[model samples]
Target: MKKVLIVFVFSIFMILIFTVDFPIKGDSLYGKYVNTNYQNTICCVEAPHEPDTLILFNDGKFESKFYGKGWFEIYNGISPRIQLHYTSFGKAALFNTYFSNKFFEKTKIILNADMNHTYTKID
Candidate 1:
């Protein structure tokens, strides 16, 4: 009986951890993300633009334009890489041209700095 109770408690704890909100920090993008490492960069772009604008990271790799209605398609060429529609909304500036994609979804990303120049993301 004791073991059964302990298992139930542990399961509940795990579920809570998974359901908790984990917000991505906006300031974290101030530096460049090469492959996956953050390096210093001078480029960043904001929103209101359609979801098809290609993002060139300071590292050399390119992030394809986000598709899906209201969703920001952030293609990092990594896991959790699937389309992430903004489950929540926040303030972000938009620049450059916009492209059309049907998978739009509302999403938000905190910027470490302003988007002023072009950046590259190398692998």
Candidate 2:
């Protein structure tokens, strides 16, 4: 009886630790951006813009869309550069144009290189 109970408890613990969903992605990345800045030939300081940089954590991955471009969701995986502390849109402008970021010691910002969107955490 003791061995059986131990096994049962162990199984449950494993399930909770490994099978459970951690909101790490959602908590760490999901939210709306409200300011923006464009850095081309001349770098402009922070500017006002819409929350075009939208990031959501669903299922078990991250999905970022710009200006309601759901079709680009299919390409979110175009590269891992999409999710980093600091990034450049590069030639893959389709994938990089939006959701840029500069990771600070404690905070990070995602920008839209093309759309020029910014995110501000409301929650």
Candidate 3:
């Protein structure tokens, strides 16, 4: 009985460790992502005219040319999500936006703030 219980417990533990959807480390996301064709002109709030580039640090902090600085969080699941809680100095300040990880494979990622925008990871 003791042996069976121990095996069962170990199996459950291993399943949780391996099967659980763990979030990717911040290091994997630590890089500069640029959206060359980003446009916020159709948005209700005024925004910067130039394109947008986001730099995510290993410490969960992110900075952008137009989106100021703030912390970021990544949720892992069937459909992974990256939430950016930033503050922009100009009229286009959004508290947070859940950026869908459309295609996160190696150095390329597609994020959709309002529309789908492909971002390439550049060190």
Candidate 4:
């Protein structure tokens, strides 16, 4: 009975430590890019009016979106592919890039593009 209690307590402690939020702080945009282990290749053109957000995974996958709604996702593929959706003047374009994350380092934005964006993560 004592051994069981100790094991249960240790398991609970391990869970708490592993599940704790380990937020890395810095300029929310630049810091987030670094925190995701993306190295220095990440760049943003035509800064958004709001903060950019990042969702990172241990498997070398990530998603980032600007507050104005411009976004991209990186997947594990032979070639890095990205889909971008932006709207300007009430017109929206969904652009697809057949590039590999290993080769591309910057996220580019063209002016007069729609800005509202959303991202979803899949396991």
Candidate 5:
């Protein structure tokens, strides 16, 4: 019984480690990107008011303020893909994040469509 338990625990740990890079569970997107502009690495285009507000929680949840409207999601993730289940619209929005071309420095780009309103990180 003890040997079986050990094997089970090891198996679980292996699964966890293997799935970490599977997009559904990447560890990089578990933090806050507040007051930061995730823009395209190519042109780095951003509008004056782009990315009005975006908040992604660690528990696969998100709340964003865009165009004076609240977009809430009970379950969301930014790995593998940036998917948001908007409760207000009763739908899901799949956004592809672009990265900075800078070698030493980097940035994340959360696109909606047109980058008419994204700016550099204020703080």
Candidate 6:
């Protein structure tokens, strides 16, 4: 009976550790990200804004003044593929990148689409 109790307790502890808000490297993705190079990244000659900004929320929602508002999901281990689902009628976008815990700590994210764009985390 004592052995069973110990095993049960250990299982519960492990479950809490995994299900609870244990900090994962991907958690760093949540925050405001701004396109470092907006001018040269886009093909358009005329530019609307100097730098495009995107905000990713912890609730799996994201918004951008230039793009629109939508839900986003990241799939993978450390280096993950991010998919942005735009709810608004404007536009939708996808960005892929690899970020280690060490690299994510710097709050810098690089998203690759047609071209590689660097986004700096503001908050």
Better of 3 and 6 by lDDT: 6
Error of 3 at 75 (Å): 0.7
How well does each candidate superpose onto the true structure, as a TM-score? 0.26, 0.30, 0.53, 0.27, 0.37, 0.55
Candidate 1: misplaced stretches above 4 Å? 23-49, 52-123
TM-score of 1: 0.26
Candidate models: Cα lDDT each: 0.33, 0.39, 0.59, 0.38, 0.41, 0.60
**Candidate 2 at residue 10, lDDT?**
99
Q: RMSD in angstroms, all models?
A: 15.6, 12.0, 8.2, 15.0, 11.0, 10.3
Residue-wise C-alpha lDDT for candidate 2, range 10-59, written one tens digit per residue: 99988666543232232444544343443333343333242345444343
Candidate 1, residues 61-118: lDDT per residue as tens digits? 3344342123233333211121323322454423223211112211223223244222
| Candidate 2: segments with Cα more than 4 A from true spot | 1-26, 37-66, 71-80, 83-93, 97-120
Of 1 and 3, the candidate ranking higher by lDDT = 3
- Which of the predicted structures, 1 or 6, would earn the higher lDDT when compared with the native? 6
Provide the lDDT at 7 for model 5: 100
- Model 5 poorest 10 in a row by lDDT: 67-76
Candidate 5 per-residue lDDT, tens place, 17-109, comes to: 654433323444444444343443434322213345555555766555641222323223334334444433554444344322222332333
Clashes of each: 33, 8, 0, 7, 10, 0
Query: Which is superior by TM-score, 1 or 3?
Result: 3
Q: Write the per-residue lDDT of candidate 3 for residues 1-123, one digit (tens) a residue.
A: 999999999999987665443444546667897764456444434233467777988788888876688887776565456667765554434343333332233343444445544465666
By lDDT: ranked, best first: 6, 3, 5, 2, 4, 1
lDDT of 4 by residue, 2-78 (tens): 99999999999887655432322222212133112222333443333334454444443444554224544443244
